[model samples]
Target: MTITEPVPTGPATTLPGALSLRAEKQPDETAYVYLRDGEEPDGSLTYRQLEADARSRAAALAAAGLGGGSAVLLYPSGLEFVRALLGCMYARVAGAPVQVPRRATGLARLRRIAEDAGTTTVLTTAEVKHDLEERFGDHPDLAGLTLVDTGALPRAEWTGGFPEPEDIALLQYTSGSTGDPKGVMVTHANFLANVAETEELWPVGPDGVVVSWLPLFHDMGMLFGVLMPLSSGMPAYLMAPDAFVRSPGRWLAAIDRFRGTHAAAPSFAYELCVKAQEEGKVAPGLDLSSWRVAANGAEPVRWRAIRSFAETFAAAGFRPEASCPGYGLAENTLKATGSRLGEEPPVLWVDSVALRADRVELSAPGEGAQPLVGSGVPVLDSVVRIVEPASRTVLAEREVGEIWVSGPCVAAGYHGRPQESEETFRATIAGQEEAGRFLRTGDLGFVHDGELFVTGRLKDVIIRQGRNFYPQDIELSAETSAPGLHPNAAAAFSVDDGERERLVVVVEADGRALRTTPLDELEARIRTAVHEGQRLDVDEVVVVRRGFLPRTTSGKVQRRACRARYLNGELKAAAAAERSAR
Candidate 1:
């Protein structure tokens, strides 16, 4: 990573305000490059071109009487989606960037976002509009909406003022795989505030190059990947998530080819990249020294896997300190806490027994030590606290509890959800003199040495004999206990038995393993391993074929969904136990 001075805090706190600044400073500079498969970009957008495209679409929306209203913008991964979203901001309209419904994949979520946002207008590209018309022409949810192709609209001579700092910029919809989706109403100021914080910590400037393959509909990818380059005056390279999945090496190759200075993805992606290089799938001699900010966030941070990645890629000029493990959610607009600019990612060795007792115990290298990677402290002006869920009392340092965040980056509230918003976004910590309002993140973690170590989700924590056990730890034990299981292809949860919580483990193995290994023996290994690791009795163990486990769009294992499938006997064919253990 390139060591540099910390970036100054945000001068432009709004997208429109930032756009005007970029246009005035370096209008002809390249802003973004959209790549598909090869080295060269499929399409490119410059500062002037980006501003003009957004202006044309904004003028079209204004002419259509959509000013100061909400609109759903759906488009495939490309530069056109960029134009549509920014155009909404320029038009002073709240744009909801959602995945287009096709063959009933994500249609229901789209409907909910549209209804929740109170928007009837659907903004998409010409090609996607044809697909929606063919697949959802008679659909009731989209029947009354005006479908506009921002790409096809003739260039309008836009002459109106831009959006205000307090104007609505975008509506970020939560992935509702576990439950119903909610639209997070993000203002322009909120989005830019986060960008400023990210810049201050990561320290990227006009000389930097940003690369991303994360989906644009998600917050991590959209705000940091698509919009941050515009605000920071850095050139960016964009690719679809599928593009990277098809060939993980393409992501690293893009970095080497374009001299990428900043990039962010979930931990799973880093695993994929490391695996690709290990398997000789990536071409040799790819230099990653230019990769300054290799951020890992939007999912669980693994200490061993990331350290292994840094060590493995070090032969290719990858620095160990470049990998950053951070934490954030949709409510904060984007980044909240992340790694420092020039420090190695921190990891804590703690006692596992004490972890279950709501305590943080520092342990030496051996003697039942569990290593956890640190999610660095708050950036810029955001504040974080660990609070007891039931009493809402703030927890002391090294005490595990629910995470609460409060800052200007926090959104006003969820769109059209007064009650839910008040409950979640307007939470107050009990017994604190200046508790004030905070956003309950529903995540369980602790502060050690002033850094965050997120343990697990509050709903997914397994309680056995009044002690808390994180399912991810148990799932890791299950995956590593056997040779057949795949990493991240496991989900662990607890079955509520009224008296106490019993552990239930579900893992994925290839067809070869399912056919070769005896199911009884496999289940016993998983049971014994989880029991030994978490000190909890395993009630059930199920091994399904790979791809059977349900996952969120961002690649998180859906424990609640897996529990539903287990209760309904949908996963019986994979691995079924005759007796239930209590």
Candidate 2:
């Protein structure tokens, strides 16, 4: 399953310049479909038209005194936003896209990203104009910067031109919901290689139409929804995230309406679709038979979510083989591993206890508390291996270790922050960090029968009583043990109190439901479950309101934010106090 085979469709055309290689293959095909407010819910642009628009925007940016190697920040996702990114490519300028937060507190995230990049020229939209102006307008580092509005940009200014493949095309910033976001430097060559590899691994035929609600700022959305379709000569059906959040049914409806055959999303998205189905929100008689590839990646993939989604949507003709779950990161240009075009879901069940103890022991269903989905074998030309955390020695099959990856898919390295880059990007073979450099994924997992299975995170592993426990396992147990707890709402982490580590379980409570229940019963239920199911002695079980969980725009829970609130005495430890009163 190592990535060494040529793409079934064959190599891309010899492009004279970067961004042109893929564009040359499909000049008249639709590249992007944008959803906007007050206007038509969707807009489409062909490869030729998008290229022209990008060139015009690039010329305008060049006229504004920006040129090759200059870094610009892109904030919004739409047809115009895509045009601006293309403009950067046409002008030989590099641009980074950051995740724009919907709330005010998210401004701090943007500021942190700006500080990390040390740039000022930002591409924004009218909706976020005031917020950006107020939050970052007066900053010294951003002086003399231009904040271009994608919606208001004049289309008459751009004229089609081309840039070199060696020229820097984009700088997509990582969604540092975990830590500081780094600007990943990508050239036109990187995009071509990745797109070629993706097409190789999962071929999209001429009739294929892509539909996606994933944000364009994100790597998967931009690469697959916007870039790959153009390269593959396919149309994309796009809707806004708000549209899908408001009515997930619309996502399926669009697929039915457009006959979309290709799409991608995180694991939670499928879970949301399943919830929407349970609420009877899915339109009747809608068909998804045309959906040949529904890629699941970008974050941790849960087996429960995948199976639930497949079962719920079976009546809609969504094939089990169509649901592809895999692995990747922004550093690898969005895709690393995924199911073949028409294969059943790849999965592996492992013993929950031995998995926590540096052992990659497999188990049958119902024998373990958790079963992780396999992210599939490496894509064409990519390599995946598991290495021991301390020694970096390559472990054999079914040996739990830190995942190390190499191949053409790995990005060059992070932009700036050399020391941090060295630590993360350098690979260790035979006890040396510099032995052979591969992207240190910081993820804990192993290979079984040549398939990659990610259990959880290495840093997120909670150590207590000389035993390693995965927070994901404890979190899942709490959600299953309690009727009211929201799935994935609970976070379990270990904190030190001058001695051994103490296990802290934080679950968002159904505030109204808790208020009605007898306090004794609620506390008893939580305490019993933590001790019995997880086999961990908990010092505290803090429960907040139902809507208390902090999340990134991509819907990932912000555990650090929860920990911060718990430490500051903002969250009530109702369960913990109830147990003490006994």
Candidate 3:
């Protein structure tokens, strides 16, 4: 169904303004609760406390002449990042939340982001500042940065007016799964619009509580863990991403503890939780009855993950309808489409052969069918159109093509990237020029029965003999082909062998399995599976130890990077393969 323009939720223009209103309305209400190690509460902030802390930081930022400029917020996941971000809003400084570098590659990425934003100021905690200073001698690029400890900022009253609606509030950097990261300029208006659209779609009740372990630097985490809860006047319980990674059960325990009504993660997270339960990692007799929405986004929504999670958690009071698959990107300010609340996510089985032929044909569950989970319809006030990338012509329903979106929720553009911003954010639809510019999302999807079914990324499509083959299909086949392959740790791409493109599948194998199973036998299994499943010959199969494959900060496999490493012979194959090569 078509979504019309959404009604304004409130008079608050900026995020700071919304927080102030909430503080005035309910000063004693808890705004945020930080979980230390994802188990015990470390600290909690009331609305009054949060507003005061943010104002104090804002005053300090203004006094430091940071207004109208961007500052990198380099902090671990905690309440400090939240306060600093809100302070930036109050002081009219665009906050760029970046993940703290932990390695050489991470430090390089940090330098690139800092250089791209043209910012010298970094707002971080005292501990982080000291650590960076100690390491600055090794990395000269980071040595020149001016780090300000937000905790040391004096507690002064902020008198400055809130930023305007169109003012840039954040410089959200892309995950760079495909390429270099680009900072999307999300304005105050874009933030509010997206939050409003989310509320309209999800409609959080007064008793709603948000429990999240998503990284604050990522778009989904920022919106769901912070902005959405604040906008909805709900309390949020947040924990560091590492905590959740260490034990997926911590996330569920937090939900049970806080009676959390809303939570979101990628499809892999749900799979992890299912695995954790199967391995008896989750606490016994845990009641997740309070979880109203289990949003799965930021990656491909897998039907296997959805079904497995529902069945595994059914005894814990987790309803099947709580699985809400969604589609979004940083360019759209977070959410583009979400499954309707309190409804089972739609799943469609299609003929795999027809899908390769760029056609959607209904098929029953069988050997040649693929199950696709719907990511729901366009959110309120947003317009989604499927367009043929080559001709830029809108496609009919169920016809797979590039997804284009238009709405106020769309970010202003990429920061300092005029040409790329213009090309990506300002595209006119063929024969519909009057409708205005649309953001060309490089994703492939189609609308079937008014529900969006994301197929794959347009750039990741592998063309062989004039037919399109999606990498995800091949990756799925490869993962199931071998018994020891790590789930979602496979990258499938094509390499040019001078004459034609040859298919190569690079996968991560369990270390224990590599020791127990023969390398040749494992490779044979994968090759046989791909040949049987997709009827495509595998040119090469590279197996490496778990966590060796290249991945984005958000945990998405970087196929291009993997392909480059394979060609450069930089990838160190598993022990067995290495020994076999010798």
Best by TM-score: 3
**Residue lDDT tens for model 2, 450-528:** 7888877878888766678877767766766565666667878777778767778777666554766665565567667
Q: List the residue pairs that clash in candidate 1.
A: none
Q: How many clashing residue pairs appear in each of the predictions shown?
A: 0, 4, 0
Please provide, for model 1 over 349-400, each residue's C-alpha lDDT reduced to its tens digit, 9 standing for 90 to 100.
9898888877889988776779889988897678999999999888889999
Better of 1 and 3 by lDDT: 3
Residue lDDT tens for model 3, 1-582: 111223234678889888888887888999999999998999999988898899889989999898889889899989999999999998988888888887667777777788888898989999898887787646876767888999999888787777789999999998764347799999989999999888877889989999999999889999999999888899999999999988999999999989999999998889889988988999999999999899999456999999999999999999999988989999999999999998999999999888887899999998989899999878667999999988999999999999999999999999999999999999998888998999999999999989999998988888887777888888888888866675678999998999999999987888676888777788888899888888888998888888888776667788888888887876644544655743
> What TM-score does candidate 2 get on C-alpha atoms?
0.87
Looking at model 2, report the run of 10 residues with the lowest lDDT sum. 1-10
- The reply for model 2, stretches above 4 Å from the true place, is 1-28, 36-40, 71-74, 130-145, 151-166, 177-179, 431-435, 481-484, 509-527, 530-532, 568-582
Candidate 1's C-alpha lDDT? 0.82
- Model 3: residues with Cα > 4 Å off, grouped in runs: 1-10, 177-179, 572-582
In candidate 3, position 506 carries an lDDT of 85
Model 1: runs farther than 4 Å from truth?
1-10, 102-105, 136-146, 176-178, 431-435, 497-500, 515-522, 573-582
